[model samples]
Target: MTINETLIEKKFSNDLTEAELLEFKKLYETDDAFKQEVDFLKNVQRVSETEDDALFRNQLATYETEISPKKVFLNSKWIKPFSAIAAIFIITISISLFMNKDINNDSLFSSYFEPSKNVSAPIVRSEKDEHLTNRAFIAYSEADYQQATSLFQKAFEQTGNSELLLYEGNALLAMDKVTEAIEVFKTHLTYSDALTNRTHWYLALAYVKSDQLDKAKQELTIYIDSEEKFKKTEAKSLLKKLK
Candidate 1:
């Protein structure tokens, strides 16, 4: 399938032969525009999921209230208008309360809302790019996958850095978009300066998701040969899993 179609179908998680994986890596390296588009698509998915969750919660609340026997009495003609008026009043009060709460809660929430005062901010930070990367890392380390995805996407746009690409790939994987995640990991492999063993390890995991045993084994083999001690151990463990 064409790269665009593959991305749309989320087929990047599919098991690919070593040759296929390598071929895609080459394409990703050569096609800058494609990489940008894929990043954009991933970001869109992240935002859409957040919105969907909020909508689902609202729908669920509506369903629960509507289906209850208590709601039937409110539907009666005598009570309906009063109920409607009361509802409007309640909504108005809620909005006013929320606005005021922000002011009132300032002192109460101050400690919680305070930026990390003990942790010094980075000197020579790269503005939006660095900020997003830092946010993504914090979210990832905390296992906050959704926030990491959003921040990493912003990081990728601001810097197009390999580290952000790797984090973005990881975030996608955490969201179970194995194919898309594989594509992202493979894209990082195109960078001559990418951390070789780490890239290989992630790519191998992606291969495992697609059930491409041979390709996974091959990547693990390369990863194990790298100078990085920790990654070599990881590679060996992964190899055992493939076996």
Candidate 2:
């Protein structure tokens, strides 16, 4: 039997060998084409549970009109007529659900949440120049998020620099402390600083990560409507996914 067939058979029977499990994980992670093929197979497997024959036929027909001459392949074999129709039907349903589902909040967050760079302070300060801001940014750059957040808060208190709140929030986000990150971003936005628009974008991402879809959409809309050109394209894409 083929490797894939063996894996599928064993997986369904709850008896995948350790070596097979390791092989499956390696292929899924390192091989993009193989991962996509596996995902397609999984989605097609779900098609068997679909009971609406009329809806399936209608969707399949619609997809057939859209890409009529293109051949569909499954399990390395060519299929036609109802078999091809089933493949296309599953693909259409998959696309439809992807565009409409709110269950992708975690995925959308992962896809779009990039940490803002350390524009607050340079990491190359003199050894004796031990300013709190520099130390905080150094901690952040080194991925010491717990120390970074604390130092950012302290530096903000001492210097009255609202920008530190932005990094503090970013540090919290890096730690996956979504609720703390949301509050920090919200607080940072209250100041009339240059980071206000950027904070809105980050805040929207925080809301999305927290599964607060309505707040995420609202913050995203605000960010999209702003003049901050940095993440506008990504914000628009994320907003569309939320819808």
- TM-score winner: 2
For model 1, state the Cα shift of residue 117 in Å: 22
Error of 2 at 154 (Å): 0.4
lDDT of 2: 0.78
Q: Please provide TM-scores, in order, for all candidate models, with all chains considered together.
A: 0.44, 0.58
The clash count for each model shown is 2, 0
lDDT of each prediction vs. the true structure?
Answer: 0.59, 0.78
The digit string of per-residue lDDT tens for model 1 on 1-243 reads: 465545433423455567766666666678788667656645544443323334444444565477774543222222323333344566789999877755443322222211111121232334455466677777776777788778878877887776666766777766767788788788878885535357677777666665666887897888788775645665686577557
Misplaced by over 4 Å in model 1 are 1-130, 240-243
Q: Which stretches of candidate 2 lie over 4 Å from their true place?
A: 1-103
